[model samples]
Target: MSTIKRDKGLDNTLKVMKEGYLYTTNQRNRLGADNIFETRGLGGKRVLVLSGKKAAETFYDNDKIERKGTLPKRVVNTLFGKGAIHTTTGKKHIDRKALFMSLMTEGNLKHLRELTRNHWYMNTHRMEQMDQINIYRESIILLTKVGTKWAGVQAPEEKIEEIATDMDIMIDSFRGLGTAFKGYRSSVKARRRVEDWLEDQIIQTRKGKIFPPEGTALYEFAHWEDYLGNPMDSRLCAIDLMNTFRPLIAINRFVSFGLLAMHEFPVSREKINNEDDYAYMFSQEVRRFYPFVPFLPAKAKTDFHFDGHKVDKDTMLLLDIYGTMHREDVFENPNEFRPERFLDWDGSPFDLIPQGGGDYYTNHRCAGEWMTVIIMEETMKYFAGRITYDVPEQDLRVDLNSIPGYVKSGFVIENVKENLDRR
Candidate 1:
């Protein structure tokens, strides 16, 4: 329902297109079309995947187009309509994206990259003696802690703990909804809680003069854009940081997924002797195959024709990254895990986007993509090569539910992680 329209109105094709999801030819046609073209996924939708790319382009050029469609106002207030990312056109979308991109510079990302390594250090050492551990719990806390450093906020330790718990609950609400009387509820509760906390902290910061360099992301957001009515709207600023933090640190999940992927393709580990090389190729490949957000839903700013079909204003489109990555047309032997595919025969770099491509327009298109690589690279170096890890055997099922994994016990990389800085 994120981008797949759940509205009462709209035709079948639009609805299906908006859903932007695909299914295997064997399953019942969710669209009722006889020809459910086989896509990169076993349960892949061909039409959805192609439309994903087209919508990104359309939204990128919003001025030339008109975005008049309705969006899920209840979920996301920012980047919702054509004016927002989901429905904007032309220079408007690009300009906003550029503004967001500015926050993620190589210089700024350098600090973030180092921070990622430190986060790993903290989490890895926390369970140095534990035989079996939960990587997700450790990683999520690491992200929250790291995000605070970037935001420049310094709440009490208790406050940080409470806020982190609130955010987790809010995130889980999405998956928890289906079980209650065959209905579902989006978990914005945690978001709201965090917002309230941010409000309190923002007000406190404005009243005081404390802009630390390792400040909270809220400080960055507040100061990034030119001051308008109020020069110190910390709540809005905090929301910006939280929003970006939630998705931006998605690299943490990618780190986990990348480790899991490498576990499958054991030979890939030898390449990690060079951390930089392994980080780039492995993170890129794993992201391409198992993108954190598989399908991206965007709104078209104007009426346009794509792939021989006419799309109306504000039409919802699904970007099928999962299927698209596996497109036989793009990758050679799509299913195989070949990190070398990214490495040119001459070893020159090629364009590979597990994050996204075609103007980089997508809902979960994280701002700190470079940081993702840094974290993954450091993590791989620690476990895959520098430090050996023993991965417990487990079954991996394509968890349609979330970006990470929907398995009973996600992957556990254990071997008493200690002294990672052998370099």
Candidate 2:
């Protein structure tokens, strides 16, 4: 076995900050490595960055890597609450994941899609009275309603904006250092308020003061038992609930990108409208073409060799999610926004992981990934066939350097109207 090649410096933290999603793949190209390389980041911690399908398979192997103690404290506290499923391992992870997966039944997915469709219609109807609409902003509000309703959380009609802003802060905190601290503080405060509210709701449900519908996420999580066969703590249950709630809202990013794709590629709109399979293809293309999560982090479970390179125990491993999805070896014409590429997709877990890869039930893939696809497909179909909106002058450029990047102008649309032809 050979020693892994390292990017020598005090740390490559500055490089990572500057390059963002391109960091690891840039290193691989610069070093002339076939797949894996090492670099230091964030407080001079040694990180092994991996790319490509086989590398993803190795990175996600539960026996080789674990998630607990891997993420930054700021990320854990803000983006994923402390003690979240993102920070569990072994049987604890498996059992908690089961609780989450239980809520993703086909019936539940259909319910979520219906809620999203209704909420989207209501929001667009209101937007028709206005001069312009920011799809990014409107998506947050619309999906927040869908998420809260689907999860059976009860926020007052007046408090929806506040709750939505809080979730946005949690997601926004994961970016640059200058704003991250401030964002983190805002996230902490928001999480506290939300968790407190959820804890009270769980308690009320248990005490019969309020009853979330049976089989709803809020209800199931409230009453879920942990691996030890004891009722999960109310606070932890609240975090798990937010795990479901927040990601659904985060699909706002994809909604923005999907709408942007329709504006940029007008030809796709016709295909999506006329064919159901094309909608799926369009949604998958949106996910693959856009930048959302930059990378996934884990830690070595023990010293191991990957592709003939030694990786020491407890060393940080960053999987290049963005780069992997765009790898030329895996995607033909990797930079283009082509939807037809997915028409015959083979359903490989290791490839096309805009979200993380591996088995959703056994590994660390996002539990709400299926729901995200469903929501995106519905949004694409709505944009293509059901609604007509004008894409006015706006900065549609996306800053790839920003973590969880958004279109510069938030993808504005004017003269919103229901498609009279479709009606």
Query: Residue 217 lDDT in model 2?
Result: 91
Q: What is the clash count for each candidate, in the order shown?
A: 21, 0
lDDT tens readout by residue for model 1, 265-345: 777777776444765777667766663444444545666665555655654554455555565545678677777677662
Global Cα lDDT for candidate 2 = 0.86
Report every candidate's CA lDDT.
0.51, 0.86
Q: Residue 75's C-alpha lDDT in candidate 2?
A: 83
List where candidate 1 sits over 4 angstroms from the true fold: 1-71, 77-99, 155-162, 172-186, 214-216, 224-233, 344-356, 360-365, 400-407, 419-423
Provide the lowest-lDDT 10-residue window in model 1: 176-185
Pairs in clash, predicted candidate 2: none
Q: Give the TM-score of candidate 1.
A: 0.74
Q: In candidate 2, what are the lDDT values of residues 18-137, reduced to their tens digit? A: 787887777888888767888887878778888889888988898898888888888888888999999999998999999999999989999988987777777777989989899898
TM-score of each: 0.74, 0.97
Name the best candidate (by TM-score): 2
